[model samples]
Target: MCSRRRWGTSPRRGRARPICSTWRADWPGRAVPTSRNFSPWRHFLHELAGVQPDDPVPLDDVAELRAWKERFPTRLEALLGPLPSAVPPEVEVVSSEDCGRYRRDKIVFDVEHHLSSPAWLLVPHDRETPGAAVLAQHEHGLGRGKDEVCAVDGGDDGLREHIRTHRSDYGHQLAERGYVVLATDLRTFGERADWNPPHLYACDLTHVHAAMLGRNLLALDLWDLARALDVLCAHPLVDPARVGMVGLSVGGTVTLFLAAWDTRVKAAVVSGYFSSWASSAAVAWNMCGSQVLHGMLGRLEHVDLAAAIAPRPLLVESGTRDDLFPIDVARAEMAKLARVYDRLDAAAHLEHDVFDDGHRWNGERAYPFLDHWL
Candidate 1:
């Protein structure tokens, strides 16, 4: 899921020499490189967009998207290193219950993680007709208490508390319609990345510490998602070829990245968070530390990430009143993507549903698209 390139303010569109034979940072002036075949211009392009590097890249065409995603799982493997090819010894399902209205059973399982991290996996009880699974991704911000991503009803007052107070409709709704739903937590959110009380570091200070490793929490969180996929594929009921992903806000951001980087994900729904970077940076007050890139303003835009999902079915749900991402910009960005998908001969698969709301998922419009596609 790539964003737009803010060309006017991006680093000069100059060619970059390889940072080094081994690492990108070793390169000379203006060159940003990494240990792998890092694309500094791509990096700089992200910076120009006012979105952070940890954000997913926008897709431009089916060919381009497929090419980038082909090796994503491999790259992730390199990062996490030889993940459990089989379920971890500590993996266990602790509980299961039927949510009467949705007609799907909610099951909670635990995976003992190496980082001393423990993850809870929630799955819908319904069985798939054939090959199908939906990765119900969660947003960031929760550090404990309750995870709202797993709740079916968001509850009164409608605050959208994630798993604790609501079941992510994106996940459970699809399960009722006959798809195995996989919902899990990302680092620093929900139970996986919870820090002890009196957090070692306050939320606002994450960026300063990220400088120590030349990385950010988003980068690390995404890595965890990639690993979760490994476990998802290992399940007997899961279909490796027909996996799809859906998320809102932060979850939507990761959905874009996961679809772009992981071939295993066949479709995606990027909700509430899809919008043009140019307009977003200019007006949205919600832009946070890692949300804006170091030098992306002049090169790519929000639509680019949508382009990356080319050839694959993608549905973007935008809230008309969303303060973080303008609806008009989202429509325009989606239009840019429509052309790219058309060029790839997969135009029929692209779709967008806009609603009158702010920053929250409409839920009603997105699931049917996933049903039709995956």
Candidate 2:
């Protein structure tokens, strides 16, 4: 009355006729709620069809793995750019010679993306028909140089030092054992980079964005890896079916994901990064960096991702004293995966090499596994 507007009022009691009095008659019975109770099977099918699954789906089945892969093409584009084109580079062996008992070379290529993923290909001197090929993945801080790529003597200086001192550089030793070896640099690392901030793992977020062009920095690095594989498989002397990958630390992380995502990778030796998520949760330095994607935990655990490689040949190298990822948790996770592998009757395919040291790859244990599987 005070010249004020009245508040909008609800229908008096229950008596404002429905918006459409006849609308109720459109259905023969009281409206059935369109939403149904949650069904796990339906969710599984939806995820299988490229619709993201509800927060979690049963992780043990091959069907789920296939479905999760289906979701990637759609989701990856939003987070990472289109899959990098796979234009096999014009591989040319620029130089070749003997490095001790092994034959080594400086191999160059004009990769499609101009990524400059050069490598040193090594083979046992005068050996033919090697059992397999091992793509030696280098560690985080080092750029892949000849010394880093072929660290046969086990001395220090980036990856070369890590491999040489550890007696692993499986690239060098594996070649000596008649296994063809291809050791190359991931995108932002090694001789591949002509300027500053040499490695991706150590760079600032801004650097990642500037270099990778809206791609998840880690994903960009791994894509380079897949492209490298494209070249290796084409090698006339290499046994395409007997291919393996091995590395330490972040290299281990790549080893893990590469084996899971690419079935063509028949075997792998992952060191310095095998401990369980629960164990990794404690150590401050153990966490690789802020870039470890936030969504990995919300959806899949490392163990689950490891299990995704079940029935395939996988060798996890863990450090008993390593603070990065706890040893006990790693073993427990391995046991969980063993059950799945057992179901597939390929239980022998999964193995763990527990070393007495911390944060390093145990090369001795790893080499034999490659010899056996590849």
Candidate 3:
């Protein structure tokens, strides 16, 4: 006798049905019944398994790499929808202060027609001529943005603890090293969060609203960052030819994409955010609306995006104890990216700094890497 088991109730009939009915039970000999619990998350994981790009661009050699660079940005821009038009970033210096080793200037600048951004411009007093410059990107936090990167004095205990833990004040560090650093607030963070509802993250609401209008939060951020670059380059102490970028977490995401898309960024240091998308998707809160691009998973991965920055000096930093972005996955992805750099004969230009720490700015190798490259 064959054992019968109830599978699921029928929606229309509202009756329980045996997983193995007579017809299914025997055709030539017998049938096997497979049972499993239903889970949307599990289904999503299954869907993501072994996914690859529909039209993968080649990265075999210099020519192929160049072709991939040319072709991939178009595909990426499509996913990003449209970007705002370029405008003269009418940079205005709001105020300036002489902080021990460097001068900190509060400035405002235009990003788009009606959009503007505020930032901290740190210039080292020792710099005698126009020298290397860096666009320092800040991580995500409540009542925290460029302030964290610039090491501003006041914030909530959480923000301070985060700064202490992550050593989040790399912009100030760069200034001490004689690089003029521009750290700006991405939209929905710090001073830009005025439109946010009480107790709600501004990025969530802005991402939702932008999507409704066929825009993307990241695209908007990239636009603003580009304009910020205009202001950074236009500074008397900055040489446009010697520009680099560095960021961690959400800041790292923008750093990676912006370096890939814009040629002006001569070097980039991406920290705390270099693992695969599949790895990130496993954790529910690891991804957000602002970081998403429509239909990106099947078409691209973090390796591909990082690879696009190849032939250009890039240093990727990963922390062993960073649970948010697992170190093992970052190592695996970096291995894949290494192949692209090798094929381009730019292996020397690529470096991975795996540190014994948590999700934070490990600039042990980063400072020297930028000095060597920029």
Scored by lDDT, model 2 comes in at 0.66
lDDT of 2 by residue, 58-99 (tens): 336767655755564344334334456767587888889888
lDDT tens digits by residue: candidate 3, 282-373: 87667765577767787777888888888899999999998889999999888878888898888999999999988889999999999998
Instruction: lDDT winner between 2 and 3, please give it.
Output: 3
Off by over 4 Å in 2: 1-81, 141-146, 152-164, 194-202, 205-207, 210-212, 276-282, 287-291
Per-model TM-score, in order, reads 0.67, 0.73, 0.86
Clash pairs for candidate 3: none
Cα deviation of 15, candidate 1, in Å: 49
- After superposition, candidate 1 runs with Cα above 4 Å error: 1-90, 98-113, 116-130, 140-146, 152-168, 193-204, 289-300
- Local error of candidate 2 at 288, Å? 4.7
Decoy 2 TM-score against native:
0.73
- Report the number of backbone clashes for model 2: 6
Weakest ten-residue segment in model 3 by summed lDDT:
22-31
Per-prediction backbone clash count:
56, 6, 0
